[model samples]
Target: MKWLLAMLLLGTCTTALAQEATARQPEPNTRVPQGVMRYAPSGFPDRIVASPAQDARTGFSVAWRTDTTVGAPLLEIVVAGDSPDMGDQRRITATSVALKTENGSAHHHRADVDGLQPDTLYAWRVQGDRTWSAWHHTRTAAKASAPLTLLYFGDTQNKNVSLTTRVVREAMRHAPDARLALYAGDLVSGGDGEDDNEWGEWFEANEVLPTSLVVAPAPGNHEYFEEFEDTPQERRVLGAHWPVTFALPGNGLAEAKRTTYWFDYQDVRVVVIDGTSALDLGTAKAQAAWLDQALASNPHRWSIVLTHQPFFSPREGRDNVPLRKHLLPVISKHKVDLVLQGHDHVYGRLKSPPPVFVVSVTGAKQYRLSDEARRTMRPVAEDTQLFQVLRFDGPRLRYEARTATGRLYDAFDLVDGGERGKQLVERDEDRIDERACTRAETLKGRTDRCWE
Candidate 1:
């Protein structure tokens, strides 16, 4: 039935024949022939993704990829109703670009849908000539201080993406109505970060979730990588796929446009900073200036900053001193609500009030928590895959951190204090014991072990 549905959707003439023809062509972008990337006819609208609009309440953007045969870039959206019909819909043409990936070549299309009514349900789909994707549905951001929920993830760098997929799927199941999905970098395991097959795995793992939920991803150290062979480690450049895949708001300064950006959703503002550009390219001053400006021009009552590197290092030997020194004063001066971050594969949350820093992991990668983490950060956990669901209702913000199996490990609430400060109320939840690597395990040459 599924095969029949696909054939009917593609039409008889273009279905099997197109797949067979495109399969025979050589994929020049990759060092080796990659079977994971299905070229053209088979890869129609495979990498469909969406992001929160620069102005979240009234706008959103989407991007997708297809083979060369589908030359025209188009998107059609209809206000969802009781009836299912394509006639009463609005069609918007998009700007198209031909991208040559390491594994193959495909056409990428991006469209920013603006002037939308707030708190409305809409269905949209993309097309390449005669091939059309099934309609996907999404809701715009609400204008008022209605309750809003969002999912936050840590580094997802893994060769096998099933681990991260399981956590993400469980998180979505837990909070099906989450408006935005925020990732704190390292979406893939490829060292150079331009491996198309790995990106294909990532897209396959994510499925259609990004198509509806707005994704705001900050690039970690892994996102910038050297070329396949000749490029040295120090010459690591931004992955080509990062810019083309996500249609993020380009409100960043100079060279940090897409990687370092921010947007307002509902009653809150999220600022995404580029730690790699600041540390690697000597752009800390520029990024810091932009952060000050972004925080200064804020109209929302709640402000949160998202960056790949944490201000306080969870691991003792792995310190991001430069990042912390450059950005901490700005964040402290602004009194940001929460600082969401990744990079340190352990889960560490400070016991302090507003501007609480949290470092967690959603993938299978594990790292030992340092002594400072265990003593300073309350309820620290090691070797645990976790996800965070944050709820904002006017002046109060509630955060719940759960493991992959849906166990609530930590819970806290922040109440707005107006001119004073936000009050941090912690919750006591009974969970598993904090785990660490045994001394025997550490003796076997594994450095990332926990100590009792």
Candidate 2:
């Protein structure tokens, strides 16, 4: 009986070895195209953000990371049929330019997929020679006449991995059908590759939605890193990976490149500005001038502006006075419906004017609201992770601010255009029962502060 058992064990080991050998064997006409390593040659897959622009309904962009430097990695997209089953999928190929990071000097790959069906679902994978990633899925934007929902989040600069992930996941759970996501700014903790792990965590936390959700990001002060250099010209690097990671509308400030751009989704025209460039680098003239042109040329029924610094912040002395003076007139002139911003790490909505201005924070950190902030804004909250859900139907626009716990903190709507822009219709909804922090706690005693 012992002899028979030994023989059986030997046979089992032999079969396992044969299978392993077969799995390790390279495919014909390919280099090392066997085993799991063949699927991910570059181990560091990260910073995945997608954007839908140009012909938004039919086009999308994806940016991801790789372990080593390579020349222009290609992305393959497969449009899945209406059936959710895996057998009904068809694939197409596309390519994007490569970018190099400073830390570990990894290669970042970005690809823009266009000429797709409007409001269609697609699956995609990133690949290099002898290697390929798993297929991720995404849906295109709806047509102009169709009603759509979007998720909006403020700064995720601090505790991005821990706090921001919960808020983002909650937002997704609450609004699974949300078509697009708008990030006000400060998506990263710092630009100089500091807290690089935070970037990894942020990507990992949102991996479930990175490929599917259409993300639009504006630049913040934290996105800029000062490279070690003697001349002032070389010191500033405003978001090195932003342009490479997300395919956005390249039609903003002509000289600003990807920093400022605009794209139209259905009846809404969303404009993004690089407040960091305008404020720190003195590119305000160029951005402001181009903003005027972009706004003037737009023909959409609803217009929304996104930036990092709030023109009117709850942080007492932290108001963007120069930006307010320079840009508000243009926003007002163009009759923009919403102006979304961050950097205050608080939630504020000013409804006095035609263009409603909102500053909200969605990360772990919080700030105390000041008296000035309270005077100018309504439904302000501190020490809370908040996000906004926007629904657009014809001429009516509804917005809701909710906490991470799925509580509605603020709600409002806008109806029609023209002089009625200033007339905000507040809904009689239940405000989440939460305590308002005193001004002392909100400000943290820092009265004079600005993004350096």
Candidate 3:
């Protein structure tokens, strides 16, 4: 009996030790590598993306990343013809910048291809040494007053491989001729926004789509993360990959050019602002001054502003009052047509405005709206993934908000009133019912109750 009792105690000690060891181990799939370089050449170029230049008709920019083996950036383009001949085409060398990241050192290359004809189709590709990327075709924007359509998404920052992949795919499948893809920021899950695996997933997810799609993204708070040795006093900075990976227009003020820029497509002028840096680093004054100039100089008939944080907060205890205090006056003064934003993780549309403010999310993460927010905003959606398409032509701008599964949920139109202004025309047919909670549920300990 003594021997048996001793064996049982020994077994208990072993089990406890095993449990402790397991507990001490790091979480699975959470280990971030210090660098991502392989000894051999990573071969072909990756993350190939295009952005609208200061002028979209005759100018556009292309950016891509490659391993160190590719010392110089090269691109080849041709005015596509029925039987395009590569006989006289010349390859142009682009500007390459070395980017050393936790994953490894790679070169980010950017080329500004200019002097192309408006609304003309062209084929292009990037080359690394002798290896070349597949030929991709793109067309320049048509002259002002021409019809145009664009895809808009919000907060594609989580589960990019599984969820964002589906959302983007659905949007592209629905609208193959979309001229531009606009994101409201939070493009990755990593707090730093530069994680190699996270970026890889993003690139892979987008690879299946057309490489010519121009991306215009706003910077979110998640794009700025703290970096240090774990004690938490480190200052937050913009993600290392943000500027290098994207080649945007240089039409912004000092220090915030990448996140704060503007470009005109057809009759619409899109003004992108950097709300994260403004609220965190106290750069609001400079950004506001720049926004005033941008709006004042708008040559297009329709104006829209895009940012990560909304001017009006839609969730309880979640607000960006400082952002609003600085930019609302400018928006009002300019009579901005639309203010598109993300980070609320919920969907909301306001009826009141010189500017119609819309908050939406495309990722899987969600949040319940506060009572005040629900009561104030019309047509609020919860736990729904959405993508929006906006078409601008002549005297009308049409907007449709669709779910991930291609269901049209909300629709509206803005008609230009000539000397007066743009008037909102709401389409209420086949709209989904409001998904708000009841007051009775709130009385029974529910916090996300809806308004009557």
Candidate 4:
């Protein structure tokens, strides 16, 4: 009887080993020929972000990722607008290059589809031989003749692809037809692919809507990696993947190039600034001088300013005082309509003198709203994930804040232009209690914890 029991146990062990062996076996035809560098598939359709430029009303830039082996790749484009007929689809092609990530090689592909009709819907896809992704749709910004809606998000620093994805997905569902989406930076964590997987997750999480969504991103401090162990700032990868993936306007502050650029859609002049550059990473004087010229020459009906750091932060030390001193006055003098920023990891909308400054976070990370902030802020949020949807109708703009679960947290409107742009019309609502902290302890592992 003991021998029989031992034999039965041996049989079970043999069965388990066989299953393990089978699972470990590589599929046939999976191996590349010798002398050829094996190209492991990765970074495909990641950070699937978009931006409007080059052709403003008719063109958009798209970026995605893939593993290193896929040499120079190309993008495929298709248009699916209000027309119900399946025959309206049109296709175009674009090229791509590779961006280095720590864990492995990642490629970013971008294409700007031009000659599209204004205020029309379009669908697109990306591919590399056996790796074609599905179709994603986007609506071009409406012409001045009609009203339009846009989506805005901030930070998205922590748990990027995991918890933050839900917030992005929710925002997309809440306003799937939004003409554009804006990001306030820190789009990913771990400067040099230290948490490379998080970047993948960040891209995957937004893939559902990014394929169709137009994205504009400003660089955050997290996007940079201080040179390894006491070396001066060396490997700078600001918007390396960013520009390669999205075809942004090459025209920016003359010195800053793509890092600081401007685009026009209908009546709105959207200017993106690199807060890092203004904060002394390079020549602040040069960037500041350029910003003044850029703002002064704008002729659009409304001007919207975007950056990664807040000019008026509730977090005491985090305020970009130098930047404020240099840029705020220009914004006021030029009658900039709205100023959007992130970095404090909270939401703050303040009615300053001219420009209505708004600081918000759309990622999973959160911070505490100070009591002083409550008194000055038009709307303040703490410990919550949120996004903004902005609609433009000629001279009037309607803005709404939607929570991660698709609840309308806040809404407001702005009307007219020039001097009238200084006046704001805020919607009345009961003040909401601050969101509670989700984790037991804050990730105080770094010095940049003022907001937390």
Q: How high is the CA lDDT of each candidate model?
A: 0.80, 0.74, 0.79, 0.69
Best by lDDT: 1
Identify the leading candidate in terms of TM-score: 1
Q: Per-residue lDDT tens digits of candidate 2, residues 1-452?
A: 99999999999999999989756632221122233222232554556667877657888777777766455666766676555554643344434455443334556666777788887777877765456677777888777778889989998876555567788889998888887899988876764344344465566556577776788888888777776656756656765656665667767776678788888887788888988887777777777788888888777788899999988878766757668778888888888889999988889988575598999988766667788888878878877889899998887888999998888998888888655444588875788764465433212334232111
Q: Point out where model 3 deviates above 4 Å.
A: 1-41, 84-87, 192-194, 208-210, 228-233, 435-452
Which sequence of candidate numbers ranks them by TM-score, best first?
1, 3, 2, 4
lDDT of 1: 0.80
lDDT of 3 by residue, 1-452 (tens): 99999999999999999999756632212223445432212657888888888788987888888888787678888877677574555577888888776557888888888888898887888987569888887788998878988989988776666667788888888887888888998877675534666777666666645376788889888877876736766666887778877889988878686679998877888999998878877878888888999999998889989999888878788778777788888989999999999988888988684589999888766667877777888778877788999988889988888888878878899999999888889999877766543334322344453210
Per-residue lDDT for 412-431 in model 1, tens only?
98998887768998877666
What is candidate 1's CA lDDT for residue 346? 85
Off by over 4 Å in 1: 1-43, 192-194, 227-233, 438-445, 449-452
**Predicted candidate 1, C-alpha RMSD:** 11.2
Candidate 1's TM-score reads 0.87
Mind sharing the TM-score for model 4? 0.80
Error of 1 at 340 (Å): 0.6
Q: Candidate 1: worst 10 consecutive residues by lDDT?
A: 25-34
| Candidate 4 lDDT tens digits, 1-452 | 99999999999999999989756632211122333433334644445666787446888877666676555555655566455444644455556676665446676666667787777777777665467676677777676657667778898876665567788778777776676778888886655434455465566667666666677777777765565536664644454544564567777776567678777777777888888767756545676677678778777677888888888886545557778777777787787888889888888888564478888898765666666677898667777788888888877888888778777677777877555444577776743555544445444443333233
Worst 10 residues of 3 by lDDT: 25-34
In order of appearance, the predictions have TM-scores of 0.87, 0.81, 0.86, 0.80
